[model samples]
Target chain A: MVDIVIPPLGEVEEVRVVRWLHEVGDEVQAGEAVAEVECEKTTFVIEAPVGGRLFAILVPEGRVAAPGEVIGKIAERAGGR
Target chain B: MREVFWIPLGRVGYREVLERQRRLHELRRLNKVPDLVLSLEHNPVITLGRSADPRHILADPLALEAAGVEVVTVERGGDVTYHGPGQLVLYPILNLRGWQRSIKWYIRALEEVMLKVAASYGIQAKRVPSRPGIWVGNEKLGAVGVYVRGWITMHGLALNVDLVPDGFRWIVPCGIHGAGTTSIATLVGREISMAEVSARVRAAFAEVFGVQVRVRDPTGLEVMAR
Candidate 1:
């Protein structure tokens, strides 16, 4: 489970989280971006499709997301999440 | 001159529709979309077919993203697919070595744009003369994974416009595992709306390249929306 969406014209009419790269146990790696959205104009960094360990965020930090909205999740090092 | 821009990108998100088709293949290597760039994505991706074999993408890739969907590793060849939200991803990034780079005539002009959008719902599609896309009674609605790079052609074709035939029952599309992948509201029964099959595939991609389609909005075209 690795989201962090809002792409397509992803100029973010809303996107304001900016932290939590890996914690719940930390491992994340596949592509790694974890979380760093800001869509209002630009600030993207949302990676980590698989490397595992981050648990969840749903939308922590500053708040204000929505576009393809997903925010966070990545707990799969030996498999998926 | 020769415009057919329609980037409605409504449900995009498959890694930003593969990064806007790699930024329109660098705007068709700097020609800046106009030679062609009609798009209409519907995110929910899972692509993996270059004659796929990634162990049959047997899911459980974390249950396919805990069902959020977005597991792309594309090059557009064909073997795995699942472009959700009513599926309709087209990306004629154009330049088939001057229209002769021929990936089988660009997949028979994407099987004549699904045989004229399944004959405008009258249903009667064809082009299985060896297969690539477009079919009717024999199922296989639309699906034509592509990719060229030097010949220039980014991923295009996937008109199961409004899919849900059990969401293609989990991969095996173009690789045809046990046959099944039909659409156009299930072979013309009803309910068609991917902007009416993307205006019948922008008039069948300008009538199979005979050319003459000048709609707008490739981001508000201004010399091909550069």
Candidate 2:
């Protein structure tokens, strides 16, 4: 399992998860945007860290998340499956 | 010094410039191009952002159509706002990885750029807490709204220079009720050319962002967009 952590957003400590593009069990590719977060009237896309199935979504839409927070998880397949 | 391409697109339609911004955004995201600053005046339009309240648009469809104003819903943050001739709009398509990654910092930087430009004209502008725009007392002088996908910014600040009253009469101007909008020409009590304000904007942008701006012809970029 790989943790989908929110990246450091400069001096902003908190961001609200505006929406999730993918749902649990959805296959996601690394570098693909999976969630959108907004802070101070600026919206930013949070991309996937690795290619895998979206295992969980800990942060729902309109929920606030902090930098380095585990917002979701990805389940990596074995043997490149 | 980091170099940024500054493209001055003289009067353009709102949708046309938006499409061009998207194209440049993709190139910047893929590392095919460096950061770019697109400056232009939009032909009368009202843009509603993601969290915009439709009721803020006071103008009815017939009235808007009669005035030749187009309404568009954009994928940026903030509420409803107007753009038209004489309002200098700056769309800086920049990757946050090369600058500060925080959206708060980025917005502040944009506000600073506007403030600097206003100051150049001897007009004092400020940011009101909880009211994300450049204001003179209670009257707004400039507005800032942005969309950052993959940390590459789009849809940026708009400074009222010699604003046409019709556009603002139709909307609440960023949803701020009762607070009127002012312009550089209004404050100075004289006519100000778009070229004069555009030059100020470029200087302030370069100073605030700490990047060397190189003005480029929009011909090549328009061809690429095609």
Candidate 3:
């Protein structure tokens, strides 16, 4: 399993999730943007670290997230369907 | 030093330049082109951002229309703001990963560029707490509104050189009340040429970002867009 967390965004410790590009159970490729977050009036996209199926979304749109906080999880393989 | 193209498009309409930025952004994302700093003056227009409140526009539609001011909603961050001739707008299409991957750092670097430009004219510009623009005491000297996707940036800062008073009077600048806008010409009590301000901005950007700014003809950018 791979965790999707907000990357360190220089001096800003918190960001609000603007939206998710993929829903849970959707497949996402490595480096593909899976979510958008806003920090200090600037919007940034959060990309998936590894290609996999989006397994869970812990933080939904409009919720604030901190750097290093896991906002979602990706399952690396389709297991047992 | 890392190099960035500085393309000056003198006196362009807001929508046309916006289309240009979008095209450059796509090229940059695909790693086809280097970072660019597009400097230009916009025809009179008021633009609102994603979090903008329409009520911030105090002027009625008919009055704005009579003044030839067009209201546009954009994808950048921040509230309503005005753009017109004599305002130098610099849209730096950059991949943040090349500099620092922090939006906060990028915005501060932009403000640093303007603060240095203002300082060259003996004006003290600063950033207010919780406010995201370059301010001279209570009045705004420059405004910043940016949109970043995939760590690539578009839409950028604008420094007021010699502003048209009527354009700003149409809205609460940046949706902030009480505070007004001021220009380099107004603060210095003399007409500062846009060319002079543009030069200062170019030098300041190079100094602040530690990049070699190569002034390029806008025609080359057209070739790149093709």
- Candidate whose TM-score is highest: 2
Q: Quote fnat for model 2.
A: 0.72
Q: Per-residue lDDT of B1-226 in model 2, one digit per residue for the tens?
A: 9999899999999999988888888887777777889999999999998667899999898989998899999878777999999899999999988888778788899999999988888998999987888999999999888888778999889999998754888898878799989999999999999898898889888988899999999776645544
What TM-score would every model get versus the actual structure?
0.32, 0.91, 0.89
Higher-ranked by DockQ: 2 or 3: 2
lDDT of 3 at B226: 61
lDDT of each: 0.65, 0.87, 0.88
lDDT of 1 by residue, B1-226 (tens): 3454556666667776678677777677567655565566665667764345666666677876777776666645456667787877777777765556435566777778778877877878777655567777567777776655445667777778767535566666655567777777766667877787787788877777766766556555445444
Clashing pairs in 2: none
Badly placed stretches (over 4 Å) of model 1 are A1-81, B1-24, B28-53, B57-91, B94-112, B117-123, B126-138, B144-153, B158-171, B174-177, B180-203, B207-226
lDDT for B82 (candidate 2): 95
For all predictions in the order shown, the interface RMSD in Å is: 14.9, 1.5, 1.5
lDDT string for model 3 (A1-81, tens) is 989989888889788887799999998888888988876667677888888899999999979999999999999865412
Candidate 2: where are CA atoms >4 Å away? A78-81, B221-226
Question: Residue-wise lDDT of candidate 3 within B1-226, one digit each (tens)?
Answer: 8999999899999999999898899899888778999999999999988668999999999988997888998878778999998899999999989999888899999999999999999999999977888999899999898888777899999999998654888899988899999999999999888888888899999999999999999879758756
- Alpha-carbon deviation at B90 in model 3, angstroms: 0.2
Residue pairs with colliding backbones in model 3 are none
Q: Ten residues in a row with the worst lDDT in model 1 chain B?
A: B217-226
